[model samples]
Target: MVTAKPSLELVAEVLNGHPRSISRLISRVEARDPECRPALAQIYEHTGRAHLIGITGVPGSGKSTLVRELALAARKTDRTIGIIAIDPSSPFSGGAILGDRIRMNELTGDPGIFIRSMATRGALGGLARASMDAVDLLDAAGFDMILLETVGVGQDEVDIVQAAHTTVVVSAPGLGDDVQAMKAGLLEISDIHVVSKCDRADANKTIIDLKAMLSLGLRMNSTTGWQPPVVRTSAEAKEGIDELLAAIDRHREHLQHSGELAQRRRRTAEMRMLKTAEDILRARFISRDDDIVVDLVERVITRALDPYTAALNLLATLDEGKSDDGGKKRP
Candidate 1:
């Protein structure tokens, strides 16, 4: 139960990289109360500035290695990177797995990179609802690139795209059926496709299959500007990492040039507001003598009253009880 107000000094300290305060700010916003609402508002104002890249694929596709390489590439431009690793996937721990990629440890001491691991905690859409809040916190904290990694097979990976501006759906040679098999949910959302572990023999066939599938799926009125491109990369040998990074940068430029960046921000804002409203309504409705609503519904079941009339009566009672000043009845 957070009772105290959100401190301005706390926000500033977190933004300034006060190590102890940074995690605290993230916790506060993710807990999601009225107290943290103001902080979230400020955080969203800075959100459109972060290039959100969602990296996802079926199991063992080397998403972790890919994300670390991408983060390292972003550093070349002096951009701060935030990596969010989700549950049961490629997590070494809640702490960053600096050993996953070479440059991951290369800048462990650098303030430019922030990494956090997330658990499902019983929410859907790849990451938890709190993940968006946490990302907002990171974006406001001045990270230029935020990479969101997910847990699960390909279909589950698609949900991450709804949260990101650029979605790179990774697949590998062993993941042969990823295109035709998982086409319904995740593949439809990809803005970029990645064939990782390209060192393997069947890699070319996987890429060709993906291209054919995309050719079948592309529609005349699609919203995304550029058709997603498949890039090859082998994290183990560090081959094609540069080409993959180049594809990501090209996608970012395309988004900016084609007004898709603004569209993404608008959609993100809309989702935040809708989710927040649903949360508040559920909280208030449950607290409003919920027993009364339950009891009344039981009576309706016995035919003493119709459900519609019973609901109206409940609404009147709720309205009257909530008002400090008397509100007129609905008759």
Candidate 2:
């Protein structure tokens, strides 16, 4: 059994290139445990070096394929690749695909590629936080490029993209609703727009439509310097990948030289850490005691208390709990 200290030591060892330790460390972090906190802290300290790239679009838009292509390109430069794919919660079955690894098996033999599947636990609770932690873990593992491919649900696109250094929004050729379906904030969040399945006949039309939509955004975000580029690609044919990689490089360069990258990183770090702190407070101090939790739940459910009121009560309980325990609580 790996003790907490040893486990973190092992994680650091894995970050230096030990594959077995890497797998074990990932498993340890992904599991549910209050004890994982220390390891997470060490991992967080080791991060900020990896370039996190988020990719998202509507379902069936071929996002994963594009990510796979990008992985190959990153590998050519001897970069260690980390992939986090969000398999959304199935509305009916409450299940997730959790199966993309089979399709991207070409990366299996390569020691440079580390891929993991994240189940979007639920509507408000899933995807956002778990995905962030998973990326941080990958970053600490010393991956050069961490590619995050998300299930393209319409809402929350902006929040997800904000977690990364760069974002690529993928769309397929004849997706029909390209212009009307894309979100307004998409243009602001995404660093690049990719029209996948470029071999398809309607790809050019999709490009034209996206360009038209971008023109409509000039009133709001036109002063952001470089315009977001639309790159066409065929993941299956393996065409245009080099250009896409170059485009990503260009965006990274622009962000770095323009002093925008530091600002983005600062904002991301602040939000992530604040969110995590809130979640910890919710789980430990507010929800730890049965009577206080039940009271808050009943208040909310019975409509005797609205959400804000309930939150206030919970915070009060948390404060009382802290005062009682004096910040000492065993896991």
Candidate 3:
């Protein structure tokens, strides 16, 4: 029987590109296990070298298939790829419903590719809370490229922009009203647009409509000076995958040349900081002693205290608890 390695040793093994160690670290992160923190802290210094790309779109956009094709195309260039495929959660178990192991089975035997399936777990913005943490682990493990595929929840996918250096939005033909849904929010956040399943005759309509919309709006982030290009891809025919990769490469080059990469990195850091803080506060709020909030809840329930005042009062109790503990926070 083999004993488990310590966290630091596991981090060392992961950095040395041990696949099993990398998977174990990601598992700990997804479980939100406290033991994972030290390894994550060590991993952070080795990150920022990997190119993180986010792929998002509505349901039936063939995102999984497109991702598989993109990975295959990218591997031809000899680049190691790490894929985080976010699937909808199982209502009963809160686990990923469609695992990457099944969806991307063809790529399983490749040594250069690593795919992880994470459940959205009811998280808004189409990503799991632990998704970025998994990305960090992969980045630290020396992967050249990381592809983050969201849960295909349209409009709520804006979070991908905050998490990735480049965001690709996939659009499919004959999605009925889903195309209109893109006009509402997803269109504004895409760095590159892809019309998947272009083998279908109706695909031209989607390509034309997307291009026209791009023309209407500058479709360019003023900072990056990039006009999002629509690339047509047919997984069945294996066409346009190379062009899509080229578009992504061009966007990365533009970001580097225009110095927008540094700015985007800074914004990503700030957003992550704020989001982490919100999570911490929410956890503390939920874990607070029941006795402390019961009175406040009763007061608000009876209209003796306004909800706003009761909320303030609850915060005051937290402050008091902190003071009593010599400024250290309680679990």
- Number of the top TM-score candidate: 3
Which ranges in model 3 have alpha carbons more than 4 Å from their true place? 1-4, 90-93, 219-223, 327-329
Question: Which segments of candidate 2 are over 4 A away from where they belong?
Answer: 1-6, 90-95, 123-128, 285-287, 328-331
How accurate locally, in lDDT, is each candidate?
A: 0.73, 0.76, 0.85
Write one digit per residue (lDDT tens) for candidate 1, span 1-331.
1224254556666566565555766666555545666666665666567888988877678888788888777788888998777764234433323233343566567788988766655556667667787787788788888998876554654557668988888888876566777788878778888888888888889988888888886784266658788788887778887787788889999989999888887887787778767666545656664477788789899998899988777767656665853522211
Q: Which lDDT tens digits does candidate 2 get at residues 1-331?
A: 4435456467567557566665566566555466666777777788888888888877778887888888999899888899988877777887767876766788878878988887765634225456777787778778999988876656445666657788888878777775566755555577888889999887888888888887777577666686888898997788988998998889889888889899888888887888777666755754364577787788899999998988888777766766888866423
Q: Which ten residues in a row have the lowest lDDT in candidate 2?
A: 120-129
Given candidate 1, what's the lDDT at residue 67? Answer: 86
Query: What TM-score would every model get versus the actual structure?
Result: 0.80, 0.90, 0.93
Write model 3 residue lDDT over 60-166, tens digit each, in one string. 79888888999999999999999999888877887656655565788998989999888877778888888888898899999999999988776656899888999
Residue 268 error for model 1, in Å? 1.3
Query: Distance (Å) between predicted and true CA of 72, model 1?
Result: 1.7
TM-score of 2: 0.90
Q: Tell me, by lDDT, which candidate is best.
A: 3
